[model samples]
Target: MDTRRILRRTRTGACLLAAVALLTSGCSFGSTTRPVGSAAAAAEEVPALTPLPRSTPAALEPYYEQKPAWRDCGAPGFQCATLKAPLDYAEPSAGDVRLAVARKKATGPGKRLGSLLVNPGGPGGSAIGYLQAYAGVGYPAGVRARYDMVAVDPRGVARSEPVECLDGPAMDAYTRTDVTPDDAGEIDTLVAAYKKFAEGCGADAPKLLRHVSTVEAARDMDIVRAALGDWKLHYVGASYGTFLGATYAGLFPHRAGRLVLDGAVDPSLPARRLNLEQTAGFDTAFTAFAKDCVRQSDCPLGGRGTTPAQVGERLKAFFAGLDTRPVPTGDADGRNLTESLATMGVIAALYDESAWQQLREALTAAMREKDGAGLLVLADGYYERGAGADFSNLMFANAAVNCLDLPPAFDSPDEVRRALPDFRKASPVFGEGLAWASLNCAYWPVRATGEAQRIEAKGAAPIVVVGTTRDPATPYRWAEALAGQLSSARLLTYEGDGHTAYGRGSDCIDSAINAYLLDGTPPTDGKRCS
Candidate 1:
């Protein structure tokens, strides 16, 4: 989904630090000449360009007696390890950063397809946690049987050399900052909050604050691929991970193997465009939820006469109410449903369909029972908050990476104000606020190191780009754009909703992806799945 929103609630540096404590945490060109004929040929086709050299495989030393620090991880048949790589690839001799890695061996009678890496959207989402908790044990057996499922926490993320910021009290204060400011005093408070958060990050992790861009992480992936003894990389990445994977292909095209980029990000777009598109996406998802909610008896928004527009109005009213007077959730810390938390709760429900019912129930409880515990749980889960008020490093790293990848969309309050109307037009439900919130990076302590650029990995093998028709985070057109940009790419469309396609529910999507991972066969171009 929207990387910014996901990062804000779940991995936003300050919010993440507050939550748990605490508890925490390509191508060779083949030349084919079309025959010049009167009716068939509109124009003479040019000869296919020659493909570039493949990335030379690095030598990997096999471990004879590898003993991982295994624990009673919640998932069965999984093991964890700490993998080390240089903090800066440009300086390989520099001190290394420890990455949390997890794996589950292939359960196969058939020949193995080596290691298959998986990342679930958020630049801040814990890859190890996702692997141990879901993909490692929960992925479809057909795919799991042929590859050793693997994941590595990116630099500055959970279990890695995590970036830290605010402590419990500080985080609570930061999350309560008004995101949609209508007055100068409120705007000042928001800007101060961002500045303080950025200052906290710089003070806590200066070195990391400068090095967490998607490009550096992509380089880290290459190092991991070498360490794993894989000749080429096989991976499935969603949301921001799609940007990471695409960056990898661009950097080391020849090293690419079977790749599935679901919920694709358009590498060609700048941060502002991405943010604007995402605001629209969330609005679309809310509209869908609103339509479905009206048909149900338990909808929080009034029923019958209430249209999606009315539901939007009601939610906005709730947000406004929370802004003026927060709702208590009975937490020991006296935490209440502030505007930030409430918005996050809505964003969290956009990830999966199963969570829609949860959203309905939670909204009902908040409106009718005056109890927000259900919504709080969903928000906590999204943030990966722990028992204590401590948090993992996901959000810190997510910001570090995102802020570095592109320039801030807005540099000042005036800029945000000027852009508010367009953002609001994009998505009345979340647009204006998110557009303003996009200014979080403007006050960052570190200077951005990269900019949005097209990735045309010349020698990479065929890559599959999957998009959900009405995805709330990564817009569907991004997938189409990425596929068209890649020299050897094919587009796979999921005519459905929610973020990402494979393994969420559609057998058609899963089977197609499984086939690609098993053999070296990319799905047919323009393939569609429901």
Candidate 2:
């Protein structure tokens, strides 16, 4: 529901962990109007960064000088280690949080280029998992031959001191809880679910919850950078990871080096506006899917010549039917394909066009055959639901980090009610449900510690910002905005679909990014690749 779900998967062929992304929560800001400049043009007025001193603070020098005790883990070539950082950075003597890090040494015949740290977004995504599963072995051979691929699971993420919330059954029930309420009673039910989830997280990790903010995570990255023996940071961050990378650059501009932010998030927008725009972005992606679906003979929504609007109406009607008579998914847990789960299924596939065919088949089965298993599978995959009734710490950490990063998108149901019209205008099909979903953070136990602000990272070396034309999770304008905001950023446009561009099928996008990582050369500003 924090809809920052970006780069949940590896490549097109691999199963992606659904990145729950960021959704902030807590106290309200009354009478505060949505920030203007929702457009890219307005975001171009870059802010000047006030960076931290080049010299490490005396109290934090130890953390920056700690050595990683790497041992073989995961795949054959990969190694894992734990890096320690203070629980409360401002009070280093208070306590410490150990972070999990992984890396694969460069397999080179050429001179090694230090390390290349990578993160696959999800304030909650497992960076170590991503490194072993994808980046460690899937990167360009030349790049892989030259740089040690690295990753760190930020505090409160997997392998790190993770934030624990609901158990498997509890999470299943929470996911099934109706997001689109038709009556007051249902709305209260949804509200109660959110409260219960937040409470569970608070009850589970009271202290860690308060310390998992993005700012803290960025600080953790810097410690890792220093421990790796690198003089500067070379990184690749996608989706919410982009925000992390930018924050790093802003905080340590002098140490920033060859950063690639693909599928960027705009750090300038408030939660409400981000939710609204993301709702619109889903519409944009669905429209593309609908247009393609109508051409396929197996399409369940509609046939050729049918407008995307009509396709949406049909899908909406189907959802309405499921609101009452939920279809059977034959899930081992006996969960049915409720409207909420069904919607997540559709949303998951939209992240990658390669999944569109699977979505169509799932929709056809759910709509025509009255079988909900396929859609259920998609939803399960999105949530990273294991066959054994287990779940990763992803959702819990997602909420923990998100709630600490910004103010709640909506403080109350009444606020959501008031904003429904604008949300619906953004996407007729996803508007109602997503608007309700955005309310999850209102009950967050931790009050937000950060706010929307531009990151200029001035004095940093060239940072490449890449955006897909129709990126459903983080929009292209966000890349444009981020590029415009960062003093040394180069905007590389991928005229394609899906979430992030690099390491996908585009030789152009891949080559450009590969070159940047290998040679410290960035693509020209505003360079376009199909």
Candidate 1 lDDT over 1-530, as tens digits, reads 33332332222222321211000000001211111242112111212223333443232122211234544454678877776666666665566677777889899978888889988756777787778767787777867898999898888887788888787677667766778788999889888888888899899988878887778787777767876778888998877778778888888888888988988877766566667767777787788788888888989897876899999999999888888887889977778888778777887787666678889998888877878777777766676555666666555666777777777777888998998888888888787677777888888898887776777778789998887877777767667666766778878888776777777679889888888888778888888888
- Estimate every model's Cα lDDT from 0 to 1: 0.72, 0.82
lDDT of 2 by residue, 300-382 (tens): 99898999999999999999999999999877878899998899899888888888989999999999998999998878777
Clashes of each: 20, 3
RMSD of each: 7.4, 5.4
Give the local distance difference test score of model 2.
0.82
Q: Which candidate tops lDDT? A: 2
Task: Show model 1 residue runs off by greater than 4 Å.
Answer: 1-76
Residue pairs with backbone atoms closer than 3 Å in model 2 (clashes): 8-16, 8-17, 9-16
